[model samples]
Every structure is written in C-alpha cells, then in structure tokens.
Target: MSSQAAEVTEVLVVGAGQAGIAMSEHLTARGIPHIVLERHKIAERWRNERWDSLVANGPAWHDRFPSLEFADVEPDAFATKDQVVEYFEQYAQLIGAPVREGVEVTSVRKRDGGAGYIAETSAGTIEARYVVAATGAFQLPAIPPIVPADAGLFQLHSSAYKNPDQLPQGGVLVVGAGSSGVQIAAELRKAGREVFLAVGPHDRPPQRYRGRSFVWWLGVLGMWEASAPPQGAEHVTIAVSGADGGHTVDFRDLAASGIRLVGRASGYADGKLTFDGDLADNIRLGDENYLSMLDAADEFIERNGLDLPEEPEARDLGPLPADALEPIREVDLAASGITSIVWATGFRSDYGWLQVDAFDELGRPKQQRGVSVEPGVYFLGLPWQSRRGSTFIWGIWHDAKFLADQIGIQRGYLEYDGNGAPSNFVPRERPAVAAS
Candidate 1:
C-alpha cells in the first residue's frame, strides 16, 4: 500500500449535499480554513434519485439556498429536481467552496490528544478541529424486504427510479405514500398505466392554501428562526412534516382525480402484495387529520396575532388544476397491467459511520441547536436543526451562521460570553487544533 500523509483542516465537513454545501459557504464567508469531503459527485443524489417528469411538490420560492435563490423563478411555484440541483451547483461555484469530491468518510474518531477528530476517507485521513456532519435525513431509503424473489416482478427503490420508461409497460405498485412515492404514483397514472398507491403515514399539506404556499406560512411563523431548536432536538413529534416531511398531496384532489386509494401495504410474497383492508378508510382519515392540522395552525396564527393573510386572501393563488391530479387505484398484480414495483418509502437517518456518543434513542444525533455533546463536533441538516426551516436550503443559512459563531468561540477566534455553555466541551487541548 502507498503511504499517504494526513491533511489538516480547521473544520472538516462531511457530505457535499445541500447542508454540507451551506456549511462550506458559511465557513468560507468567515474566512475559516476548511474542506468539504463528499462520497459522490456533488448533488449526485438529486440527479440520480428523481424521475424525469418530477416537479417540486411545493412552490419554489422557499426552495432556494440561504441568501441566494433561483433568479427570476416563478413565485409560489415548484422547482423541478433538476432545477434545484442546478441551483445548488451554481451556488457552490459562486461561493468557491473548497470541496473534495468522491472522497467517502468511512469513520470519524476523536484523537488521543483530545484536540480534535480524525476522518478516515478513501483518499486519505483528515485531522480537523471540528467536524460538521451535514448528511441530510434522506441518507438511506427504508425499503422493506418482504417481496419474495420468486414473485418474478421487478423491484427498485425510489433512489434507483430514473423514469417511467425504466419500468415495464404494465401497472406499477408504489409502496410508501411519502413525497417521492406520491409523485411517482402520479406520474405513473399520467402515463396511462394502472397505479396503486399504498397509503402510509404521510404528511399531506395543501399545495396552495388560502392564497399562499405552505412555506410562506412557516417563514411568517418564526419556524425558521435561528434561535429555535434543531429538528430532532426536542422529543416533540411535529404535527406536520410540511413539504420536506412527506407527500404534500391534497387528498381531495387525488381522490377527485380518480386515483384509486388503497389500504396500507402489508407483507408480500409469491408476487402478491397484501394490504390492510382499511386502506381507503385509513387514507380518508389521514387526509382529515392533515386538514385539521392546517386549520389548527391557522387558528393559532390568528390567535397569536401573526402576520398571515386571512384564509381567502392567503390562498388567492388557488389550488392547481383539478385535472393536474393523477388517477390511482388498488389493483392485483396478475389482474392489473403493472409489472414493476417502485418503493417511494422515504429515507431514514443513518449514523452508522459516526463514532460519536451524541446520538439519541431514535438514532438521531443529540445537539443543543447545532452544538453536539462532544466538543469540536457538531451537526447540521437534520430535520429542523435549528428551527422549522433549518433543514430547508433557504432555512440553513441562519444555522450555518450560528454554527460558525460557535466554532469561532470554541477556537478562541471569538470570545465566549460568561455563564454561557462551555467553549470547549472536550477537555484538554493539543497544540491548538484550529491554528491558522
């Protein structure tokens, strides 16, 4: 084996996705010496995971990067996945962020000197004073391995779904009613193929409520405020996942469009998929619950004297065309023309490679805002990392700025306030980990 020397960075960023990119930009803005390590080409997942016909499930105004956005894009509209990726790419180049692509961080471990951590990557090892784990929530798609191999049916996860042409001409079974699942199902139905959407616990927000996009309300609600806690910081389960959480389909529109609503998908074998008998009823109930939450949020806004426009005034844009809805229904494989299965089952957060001791019971890393239990270690890009918008591209700027401040304090670049949290959570220092 060739011997490789270790490189040192003031801050080492893991993952080059949206969150990681934002961190890089913030560090650059602060004139902090840092490096970004990515497993794949930047934004490769978006180019790979999305189908061709896919559009942003929500409006595009709220889908921009912190302080920057798609120039001249339509308002209260959605951006296609490709458009989103292009925007990120442009943002990265604009910031001139130092990114080392195709380097996968296999593991991160604290050094014995107690100064910082060492990141072991395929290319080489990087010793850094701080490591920002910006791997987003959608790292691993949660696919249930229940289908039998003998079923003689094609199966692939949403990450592998390129386009409808990649699937067979027959009908398709889409399990998991998350954003990807719902969007894929709609596309399949539009292709004139019989599609079955297995209802799941999905967050269904109105596409255009009252007269504005759902994200507008979130912004006006201080959901994206910098002082708010990170997404998983609190044990409180959010009432709605919003656009980023799950499928934002309006069930009324889906049903009205002739989409076949079926029960929750259960075990499958012998090329046959089983679902709960209460699929239709459950879907109806889920829709009702979602609508109720929207109403409640609206009420809270009015009671608190928030700046939201009245319902009618807010949703002046009105919902998309009713025909814009995709038709769906439950169908048995042999009888239905569908010959493939696409699992849009959403993704689960995976921290298998992290050697840190800050994870909570739900496999989420513990952090007060972005500061973790470990000193010189932090995380961003989690669901609501610092507020409702923390995870969103537009929402991440404040978190990045806040994290930069904390890092500065830790490194003595910025002095810490008295009685505040300890500047260095890890005791003892070796040669000043972040020396210029």
Candidate 2:
C-alpha cells in the first residue's frame, strides 16, 4: 500500500454509545490501535435526547462499563441519564480511546484486499482492517400509523421526550406499556398529573428477590459463571428473553402504582379512540403468568436445597377500575386536556449504510459470535450475540473478551504482528471531544 493512501487504523468502532464505549475500554486495555467514530459527541444521545426523569431500567450494579465498577457512593438501584453520561465521560478519559466525534459515517464498504474496509464519514475517510457497528437498537424509534390526525395532540417519541413539564397542564395520555412508558407514566402521576397509560402486555419481574437485588441473586446462584447453563437455568431465563420478546412491565402494578391503565392505542375515530377489547384481559393474564413463574422458581429453589433467602408471599395487584375504561375509549382531545403522547413501542436496526452482503434473510448481519460473514469484519453489542444476555451491560464483557480472543486467534492464523503497543492508553487530561 502506498503511503499516500489514507491512514489505516486496526479497528474502527462506529456509534459511541454504551457498547461502543465498552468496546473502547477493551481495545485500550489490549493496546489495540483503534479509533471510535461518533456521529454526535460522546454520550450525546443519552445527554440530549432522553427524558429528564429517565433512569436506567437496569440496576446500577449491572450498568457500568466492562473494566470499571460504579462506586458505592451511588445508589444500587438505577442511575439517572445524567449520571450515566458522567460515567461514560470518565470512562473515555480513563481509556484515552481516540474518538472522533461529529464524524458521521456515510458508507462502509469492503476494500479490495478483503481484509479491511473504507468508512466514508462526514469529516473524512477512514481505512481500517476491521469495523465494529456499535450503533444500538434504540436509534430507530417506532411510531404507529394510527395516531389520530387533527386531534391537536402533541405527540413525541420517547427519544425526544425530556420530561412531563414540557407537556400541557392537562390530563396526559402515555402510549405503550413498555418500561419507559410505564416508568414515565408513573413519574407523571407521582407529580399529580391526571396520567393514563395505554396498557399492553409487558413482562414484569420483581426488582428484588429474597431481600437482595435481583442481579446479586443471579451471581449467588452461579448465573454469572461460564459453567452455568443457558437462560433456561431458572434465574437467568426471564432476564434473558425479557427484552426481545418476553419482557413486559406489570400493568396490575401500574394500576396499583396510581397510573390509570387503558387498552392498547387502537385508532382515533369520531373524536374518540378505539382499543383492542382483549387488552384488559391480556394484562391480567400476563401478570398472573409472571407471578406464577416467580412462585415456581421459588419452589424449585427450595426443592433443590439452594441457598436462597426467604421470599415474601406474592400477591395479585387487582385490575383497573371498570369506569376508567369508558373515558379511555375516546379521550376528548380538548376536554381531557392531555398534551403529550410518547411512543415507546420499540426500535429497528437499520444498517443501510454498510454496503455489504453480510446480512441474513432477516436483514441482520450474520456472524458467528462477533466475526462476520465477511472476513475481517467484526460485530459487537448485539442482543444475544453469543449468549442470551450478550447485549446487556453486564453481558457485554463476555462478548468483548470473545471478540478480542477471536481477533487474536485470527491474527495468529495470518501471522499478523499481535504484540505492538504499550500496556496503557489512559489519558492524563480530558479526552479530545467534538459535538455533533
């Protein structure tokens, strides 16, 4: 290769979110020569887009980066979005990972050599031996098409929502029963707003079990050990399948939490909204199923003579009021005085920028562990990329180690120079940053 050709990095990480940051930590630790390309600034989306009341759904213990742990000064529960950003900032400084912010990647194409790629960005072009797409699923927000037109209601996706204070001083209608929707609805209600949550089926497990955080119990039960079985192994199963398909927040608990529960966001017609008739029944059955599973788990723990803590008897959180259902059928846009609607439906992973044939029938990039269908291309931060919890914060470490090992093994197979850099990449001052 000619020296006039663009400077090549060993690895180019795209999207500087949690996963990107985590990968950077590993790369810096191994003295890998890499650059992280961020479309916006570090932790930009988390800092700018998320709602003010938003805290991580996962507990604080499980949310830190791979090589770092949250200090005891913070609560064990959940960190607010602001705190999360602060942690990532410190992590960036700690690793001295070279991150070029505001450099949007326009295209990623296979280079002629078949062992590298050329990433065209807004700032410039980067030639690298490997590309890691750490852009998470949350980037694409899903919004329904049936939203009432001419209803004069302010609708905002959860990504754009900051707080309820931005909404008009009236009854608020929150759409979706996902974690964000339920939590935001609860926050609004706690603030004395007449808040109604459009309920759908959600998987709700107890945040704490046996008087300890659920994650701690996971560690106690060998759930974190490599020898531990798959998510099917009782304790890890629920957390594993919860996000992709099986996860749901308890609507009965939502009702008990003082948030009004309504049917699914159906359609707006004749100045009123219609909903799925089975929504109420769905919430009831979902909660029953979750609670029953918890009870079954407890029975299994006792039968196996596992060292388990005493569990509180579970109880049913009764259904929503029959009268609340009537008003929700068609909330008067002006009379009900609800100002904002937050769509927390879900996300879509669009890798349209990567012009490559690595995708499967489902359009997801095909890879064995983190290695791609195309050579020299690697992936990280995918849900269940290796195991059930592969994409979660705590689960990312295993994938990182696996990817690092794969890179090392492939380097050995090709006889590439593997031993090259100083042990440390930590910076002595604030890391260089740019805002998108």
Candidate 3:
C-alpha cells in the first residue's frame, strides 16, 4: 500500500457508541490511526429507539465511562434517555474520538491475500489492516413468530414503542417480562390503560441493598466478571430499575399497581392467546436468585466485619398478592379489549452484512473475547462477549483496552518477549488525527 492509498486509516471501527468510542480512545492513546463509522449519530439507539420515560438501568456512576462523569447529576441518580445521550456525546468529545457519523457500513469481507479486510459502505469502499465490528448486539428486535399474520391486531417491537399515547386506546398485552417489558407495562397501567405482562424466567435483584445501590454491589463484589452462561441456558435480563431515583423492581408491586401478571405467552388460536403455566414457577426461581445475591452480600459484610446499615425493606418487598400468584390460562384479545401488543422480547444479533464464517449456528460470533477466527476481523459491544459486564458502557471500557492491547501487539506497536507476555514496550499518545 502506498502513502496515497485510497482509504482513511489503518484500523476501521464500526459504530460510534460507547464501544466504538472506547475502542477509539484506546487506539488513539496507543497512537493507532483509525476511523469510527456510524450509521447514525452518536448514541443513536438511546436517542431514538428508547421510550420517552426510559431511564438508564444502571446508576450514573457505574454506568458511565471512567473518563467522564454525568454533569449536574447525582451519582446514584439514573440519567434519562436524553441525558444518557448527552453523556456519550460529552465523552466522545472529551476523548476526541475520530467518529464519522451517517456513514453506514453495508458489509465487510476479507481482502485477497488475507492481508486485510474491505468494508463496503454507503460512502464507498474503505480498506483497513483491521476491522472492529462494534455495531452493537441488539441489531434487530427479536419478535417471535407467535403472532398470527391474519390476527389484524396492531403490534410493535419494544424498540419501536415510544409512549402510551402512541398506542391505540385499549388494553395492552406486553410480552416478555424483562426490564423493558415490565417498565413499559407499569407505565401503561399508570396511564389508565389495562396492562397484562407475560412473565418469563427473569432474575430480580434489588436496586438497593444494605443502603447501597446494586450497581455498587455488583462492581465491589466482582459479580460481573463471571463468564458466559452454560449451554442451553438463556441469558435472562435482570429485573431492577433506576427510575424515580432508583427502586427495586417488584412484580408484586406491579400487580398491586393494576398491571396483571400472566404467564409467558405461548400460543394463539380461536381468537384467544394461550399462556404457559409457569408464572409462579418463574417468580419462584427469580426469588431464589434474588435472595441468594442478598445472602452473598450479607456474608461478605459479615466476613469482612464491615460497618454498614441494613435496609430490611430490601429483603421483604411486601407479600405477593394472592391473585398475582395465579396464572391466567388464556386471554381473549377482543373480549379483553387488548388492541395493541408490545413485544418487549429483546433483540437478535444481525451480522448479515458480515461476510465471514466467524459465527456459530445461533448467529453468535465464535471468538475468544473479541478476537475472531479470521485475522484482522474482530467484534465488540456484544453482551457476555467476555464477562457479564461486556455490554455495559463502563464495563465495555475494560474490553476495549484488552482489544486495543491485542491490536497493538498485532500491529507491532507493542511486543511480547520470549516469556509470551507483553514486553515493556512504551506506548505513544495520540497524534494529529487524519480526516475520517
């Protein structure tokens, strides 16, 4: 390649969100030339896809990058959707990330001679010695094909949902009892709409325990460092909330708040939707995980003999309402007056543009950490990519540093001695950034 090569930089990073920004920060700190390509503006998902009432699940302190703090906000407060986007914008500006927004990357393929990768984009073809796909794990909303096509009912994925007013005036059956589903259901109920949430296998950890935020506990306890889940076990989302200055997400409270709890929506037929008889079982399993976490925290405090106040309310989220424990067998959408269905059913990894054999049967990338089997191709911002916190904004910083170190070694900016460890190779700071 000549100095006048028809390209921008050596390393090409996709997406300008936290992951891409973090990777750009590390690469910049290591004096590596790179360009961050984003299909939309920075923090596009938070700015657009989320609902009006959406708040960050994690506290301000634990959720933000280490480089910048949320300005004019309490550490324990949960930033709103706009505030979160502002924080990302501030962080990217502070780091001077070389982000090229509105440039959509269509596909990435291995170059001939196996030397580099070619990224075909809306702008044009760009070549790079290495490619990092940080587009995000939640690409397409994974709405199950459970809804019959001829049902003639209005349906939207969680990503498309904005406010209660956007939906028609009628009862709403919210599928998927994850954070989004539960929160959205509660909001709809509060708006004077009948809401029924289909409960699934979800883990509920309190927002605060022993007078400390759960985010603090997870970080202090190193719980997020755990590896991926066992095979065949789905990674269920944790049920906790940072809304209203943070609170424990209790289903019993939601039930009491007029949001009926139903079992998982299983099938639809005869103008009625069927449910699995697993609501009680799912709640029981979540309680076990919940109490186990509290017990672990209690044991840690006792073992260390630390002086901390215990909040009894965290342990007992009031009694579960009797009717809430029972599951409704089926729901007649028409009779129930349910005119809208919100599928808060999470998302699927859409790497269709990635023309590489780096994924498994489930469309999950086959890699140790972020390094893919194909040389010069890597991935980031994926949930459980390395640890449980691999997808968190703060958590992804650690992953980005590791990937940057690996890239440095591969690009000869860093080195490993005979001991097969990183040598004492000095790193260079950011140089004058080239035009993206």
Q: lDDT winner between 1 and 2, please give it.
A: 1
Candidate 1 at residue 379, lDDT? 84
TM-score of each: 0.79, 0.81, 0.92
Give the per-residue lDDT of model 3 (tens digit) for 1-436: 2234457468999998888999999999989899999999998999999999999988887888887889967888889999989988888899899998999988888887957888888778888888898877898998888888689788999999999999998999999878899889988998999998998988888788888878777877888887876465447877887777777887888888988888888999888999998888888878887888899899889988989997666677566555446669899999999999999999888898888889898888888889988777889988888898898888789899988888887876425556655653545556988899
Regions of model 1 farther than 4 Å from truth: 221-248, 256-258, 293-332, 360-363, 413-436
Encode model 2's per-residue lDDT on 127-166: one tens digit a residue: 9887888785456777888766466778878788777788
Ranking by TM-score: 3, 2, 1
Q: List the residue pairs that clash in candidate 2.
A: 52-162, 202-248, 203-247, 203-248, 242-247, 273-330
Q: Tens-digit lDDT track for model 1 on 58-124? A: 4666677646767655756567677878877888899998888889889998877668888888998
Alpha-carbon error at 215 in model 1, in Å?
1.3
Q: Give the distance in Å from residue 111's predicted Cα in candidate 1 to where it truly belongs.
A: 1.8
Q: What are the RMSD figures for all models against the true structure?
A: 7.5, 9.0, 6.2
Selected candidate, larger TM-score, 1 vs 2: 2
Which pairs of residues have clashing backbones in candidate 3?
Answer: none
lDDT of 3 at 433: 84
